[model samples]
Target chain A: MRYLRLYLHFLRFSFSRAMEFRLDFFFKIIMDCMFYVVNLGFYKILFLTTPMLAGWSEDQTMVFVSSYLLVDALHMTVFASNMWMIPFSINRGDLDSYLTRPVSTLFFVSLRDFAANSFINLLMAIGIFAYTLMNLKAPYTTGQLLFYVGCILNGWLLHYVLQMIFIIPVFWTQSSRGFSDFFFSMGVAIERPDLVYRGVLRWLLTLVLPFALIVSFPARLFFGPETPHLFLHLVFVTLAAWGFMLWFWKKGLRAYSSASS
Target chain B: MSWPARVVSTELRKILAYRSDFWVNFLGQTIIQLFIARALWQSIFESNGQTEIGGFTLSQMTLYYLLAPLTIKILMGENIGFFSREIYDGGLNRYLVWPLPPIGYKLLTYLTYSAFYTAQLALLYTFARFFLDDRPYELSEFLRLIAGLGYILVAAIGYFCMMCLCELVAFWADNTWSLGVMLRFVAGFLGGTFLPLSFYPETLREIIQYLPFAAFISGPVNLILGRSTPMEALQSFVVMLVWLPILGLAVRALWKKGNLQYTGVGM
Candidate 1:
């Protein structure tokens, strides 16, 4: 409850900051709107050439695309700006301030800065997701809809975990952009259906990086055949990712040397 | 050496000084893009049960992806935000007193960096040859490749000028980072960095073909792929040439007006 209140404070501060930069606030929305358009258009164009891609129909693929966009927007809103600061903080030893905070330092550092600009974009993404859901040819039950939302949240969490894993390497490498670039490159996997990948690459995205699960799995759960096993897979992967994050965070902190020290 | 030549060499030396940074930053990104493009295109082709889509076989499409990064490196201008930072922080005052033209200095530096990036991409291509299937090049294709390189050079200059105009928004706005990002996204989509313009609807593709963005990337790629005839390639070159001077003029005009607004108080 205390953490919730603290997060509320962060949210308030974020909005105040956003209001001070009204032009930037609008520009970010326009930029993301363009991004969303381009993303949808890419899939639309692909469908024009072929009726189905990777066994998924055009409308079904729209749901997957919308899922990733919402996940991306959520990530940008809640985590991106905060994560971007980590390398700079570590380099400058400003992370000491975070470490000294009373709350869980990892949670505090990672979630403190809500990107209020991106929050508006997040709403736009949600609108798109709703549109896609409405237009989906296959009828879904209320229970399935709720389950899909839960899975999308899981996908967002998985994205955060994967990002943190990439970021922890900065503690040693001291190269801020290197791992971040690599992470973004890997991020492209989530944009397409996981079924497109084959062999070791498929396994890598599924188990190791888990980009496949980030967006595709949630859409799969909703549209594809009922697979009770998938629920177990999602749970196992989320737990495994969470466990790995805790271990890596602890290890990174131990190696951290404060500037004053 | 001439002043411009000297500037280029100095910038080239600076890039060489931090060559490892390039490998870490660029090479990883290029490889990742290649991986995604190859996987996505292969899957699409497999699902369609067709050997060709938009005149590109799977191997040809893979080759296009491999070459697109190189073309982008040579043609797509960097968003250095140098002039913007200078204007915002009063660093422009230092350049104003310098002997050389600031724009010339910037252009030379950008060209030098592009040259280094192209050389690095060439090295990667040599390495990639072992992994990728070889595609035979006809004499006409080689000639078109040379022509494509010329077009890429002009497109790079035009893109640099356009970026300069975008960055000049800092003169009025507090920050131009958002504008820079918008410019990049627009360019990436319209320039065919994400996918071939041919993949777009025919009407849209036809319109984009004449847009400066196509001149930047897709036009060059089409030339190298032998997708466009000699006349068509020449027409794209003409389009690039037309846009470059207009963009150059806009940059010069913006810089002149922006200079009047410069307070140089930050220094």
Candidate 2:
């Protein structure tokens, strides 16, 4: 119960702090939107010359793109902001305050960075997704919809865990900048449909790194509603990745010596 | 006795002092570009089988992508708008009092860093060339490639100077990073750094081709690919000449105007 209160306080603090930077908040929305718009334009051009891309129809591709945007926005808002703050907090020993709190240190760090501005992008993604679905003449069944929502949540957990695995190394690496860039770049894998990759790289994305699961699996639920097994596999992969990252985070904390010394 | 060479040598040694970090950053950037290009090329190939994209063969497109990181390394500075940092931190005050004219100082500093970056790009390009799956050009074509590289460098400098002109807004806007971010985003789209303008609709491509932003990447890429002749290169060069003087004048006027409004404290 006490931990709950502490988490809420951190959440409130994050909300208030984000509100203070109104221009930054709007800029964040615009930046995310512009990036998606460019991707959309690329798809438009790609489809202009060809009616289909890699067996995915124009509307199906649009859904995939929207899902990619939604996942990216969620990752940026929930996990990335917190992960980015970790290195700075550790370096400045500001992390000590969070460490000593009654709540879990992980909870404190992650919950303290709920970027409300990214909600704008999230909303835009949903609008686009809905619009594209209508255009495609696809109807969402209740079961399929439930599975999609579950997969999205699971994907978010998977994303947060993988981000933690990448970020936890900052304790030992001392500078997280390279790792941060790498993490973000790795996240770029989700921006494209999993179908684009082939052979060894495809296997790695599907099994090992499992980044494709972040978007492709949930997106598959919508696009290929008949393939429920893929959604279950995605959930299983998410769980495995979450387990690995949690273990790594604990190991990293043991290695962390406060930068103050 | 060349001014650029004089400036570059002094800058190279200073950068070399932190050589390990610099090399790591360069290597990391290169790897990222490689993978991204790999992903993009795979998609393009899958979409169109052996067909020309924007007049580029599959091999040519791969080469274009391979060359992108090197071009970015050569032409790009530490920051797109370092002038903003100068203005915000009162570093401009020091430049103001310098014996060299303000434009001369900006030009020299730009050259200094650019030369260091050029060496870095050359090293990386050589490394990429060995490993890259592309055919080498004939000797004559290779020489023309070098000339193309020179044109690209000059054009890049022209664009950077224009950005410096925009950074003069910092004299009014103060310390927000958004101005720089916004400008870089604009350039990323309009400059064909994100996606080549050739991929855009013909009407849109035509508009972008004449814009200052197109000179940043597409013009040079076309020049190297032999899409443009020597006369065409000369015309592009003349366009840059027109832009450089105009932007230089704008920067000077803004500097003088901004200086009048300068509170200097906290800015």
Candidate 3:
């Protein structure tokens, strides 16, 4: 309850701040919309020459794209700005401020900036998602829809975990951005349907590094024939990932030789 | 070394100083992106059941994706916000005090990043040759590769001018980072960095053929891949050349206007 109240404050302040830079707010929306267009266009153009991409018809592929976009939108709205600041704060030794706060440092740092600008984009993403679902040939039940939304939320959490895992390494490497570029390079998988991957690569993306699971697992649950086992596997991996990130984050704090010192 | 040359060289060395950055920026990104592209194109060809899509074999398409990002890095360079930062934070005051053309110094640093990435491309191409099944290049295609690189280098200046004009917007706008990002996304999409021009709708492809973005990326990659003869490459180069002066003049005009507006108050 307390955390939720704090988040409300964060959202309120973020929205107020966003109004100050109205032009930037709008430009960011346009920028993200273009990104959506390109992602959809990529699959669209490929489907032009082919009947199926990894067994998903063009409409199904569009749904997958929309799913990823929603994940992206939610991640951007809730986490991206906050997660992006971790390495910088670590580098500047500004972690001291957060650590001294009365609230849980991790919760405070992670949810402090709500990215109200991107919340608009999130709504836009939902519109795009609705548009795609209208074309979805296969009808889904209310249970399935609710389950899909739950999986997407999990996907967003996984993205946050991955980002923390990538940025926390700044404690030792002390590089400005840590492993973000590599993480982003790997994130290309999220834009692509995991069905396109095969064999070792598939397992690697699903279980090991789990970049593909960001949208792929949730997407699979929504689109593929009942893969309860696979969904359970996603749950397990996501839990394990969270455990690792929390442990790694603690270790990073221990290693965090303050920059000024 | 001359003053500006030493400045650029020293700045380049500083950027390469962070060992982690050096690895991620040069080595890891290229390798990972290539892996994804390889997987994607493989699935594409298998699903399509076509040996050729838009006149490209899987191997040729792989080569195109590889060259696309590299060519774009050379053309777009790094977005260090040299001018944009100065404009926003009143750092331009220092540049005005210094006996230098801030634009010239900024270009030197910008192209240094491009040059560094170009070296990365060359190094990766050499490494790739060992892993690739066939000889990656023919002796006959050698001159065309050289010609393509030559045109890319010249085109880099034109791209620099365009970006300069963009960063100049900071003088007027409250922030321009969004503009910078918008430009990159637009450039990537239009320049065929995201996908081949062949994948584009015919009308869109024809329109983009005359655009500088295609000439900057598609024109160079195709020429290096031996898809285009010297004459054809020259035709593309001519298209880019026409934009060069227009962009350069725009940069000059914008900078003059921006300087007039610049209060250097750190506002």
Candidate 4:
């Protein structure tokens, strides 16, 4: 409950900050909206040449694309700003304040800023997700719909964990944006179906980096036939990622040499 | 040496200090993009059971993707927020006292970065060619490549001027970073950084091909690939030539007006 109050305070502070720059706020929304349009257009054009991509039809792939867009929008709204600031904080020893806070440092650092600018984009993403779901040929049952929503949340958490895993390396590297750039580069893997990848690349995306599990598996759960093993795999990977993030966070903190010290 | 030449040399020296950043930005990002684009096009071709799509063989498409990242790096210009940061943080005051114009200095700095980036990409492409080993080229192709380089240089200047105009908005708006982000997103789509312009419908592709955005990336790339006819390539150069001076004038006018509004307090 105390953490909840702290998060509410964070939300209030973020809203006030966003409101201070009205033009920037609207510009950011427009920027993300453009991103969504381009993403949809890319797939639309690709589908014109082929009926199926990686065992999924155009409509099914549309759902997959919409799922990832929602996942990305959710991350932007909730986690991106905080993640972007982590390197700056570490470099300047501003993280010392985070460490000294009463709340959980990991929780505080990761969730401190809710990007109000991207909130409208988040709503737009949700609208697209719902629209795609309605258009899906295989009508989802209420229970399956609920499960798909849960998996989308799981995917968002997986994204956060994956980002922090990359970010924690700043403690040792001290090169701000290096790992993040690499992270962005690797993130393209999630844009396509994992089925397209063969052998080692498949294993790497599914088991190691696990970007495939983020959106693809959730979209698979809703659109494709039942894959009980895949659900278990997603659960296992998320838990393992969470565990690794906590361990890595502690390891990074222990190695942190504060600026003042 | 002229002032702009010295400025370029100084910027070249400054860039050498951040060698790791250059490698990470170029090699790390480009290799990943290459891998993803290869996998994507491979999947598309396999799914359709055809080796060609939209006039590009699979190898040709792979080559296109390979070149796209390098082309974007050169044409996009660096220091996206250079003018805005200077104006907002009162760094413009330092430039105002100097005899050299700030826009010229900025343009020289970007050109220096572009030169460094091209050299690095040349080395990277050499490494790539070692493995690929099948990019057949004749004398005309080499001539087209040279022509494409000239067009790219013009397009880079136009792009730089446009970005400077975008940054000059900081004189009025408190934060222009969002504008930069917006510009990048729009340009990435329209400029064919994400996909080939040929992927679009004929009417849309025709419209985009004449736009400054296509001149920035798609036009020059397609010219080098021998995808465009001589007339089409000439048309692209004409579009760039027209936009460059207009954008250059806008930057000059904006900078003059913005200088009047500047009050250097934070310094």
Instruction: Return the top candidate by TM-score.
Output: 3
Which stretches in model 2 have alpha-carbon errors above 4 Å? A1-26, A225-229, B1-28, B43-48, B80-117, B123-136, B162-175, B260-262, B265-267
Q: Rank the candidates by DockQ, best first.
A: 3, 4, 1, 2
- Backbone clash pairs for candidate 3 read none
Candidate 4 lDDT over A55-93, as tens digits, reads: 898889999999999999999999999999898788778
- Model 4 reaches an interface RMSD of 1.8
Q: What does candidate 2's lDDT look like per residue over A1-261, in tens digits?
A: 876776577668877887876756666677777777876776787676666665678888887787677777777766667777887786666777877876678887886777777777778877886777677756678787676767777777787877777677667656634265556556657766777777776787788888888877777667673465786688688878878877887886777676631
lDDT of 2 by residue, B204-261 (tens): 8777666676666666666666667788766666766677777768877887898897
Write candidate 3's Cα lDDT for A63-151 as tens digits.
88998999999988988888888888889989898888888888988888988878988999999999998899999998988888899
How close is each model in CA RMSD to the real structure? 2.5, 3.9, 1.7, 2.2
Off by over 4 Å in 4: B1-6, B13-21, B126-130, B133-137
Task: Report lDDT per candidate.
Answer: 0.81, 0.68, 0.82, 0.82
DockQ for every prediction shown: 0.54, 0.29, 0.67, 0.59
Candidate 1 lDDT tens digits, A91-157: 7788999898899989988998999989889999999999999999998899999999999999999
Q: Would you estimate the TM-scores of all the predictions?
A: 0.93, 0.84, 0.96, 0.94
What TM value does chain B of candidate 3 have?
Answer: 0.94
Give the least accurate 10-residue stretch of model 4 chain B, judged by summed lDDT: B121-130
* Superior by TM-score: candidate 2 or candidate 3: 3
lDDT of 4 at B118: 68
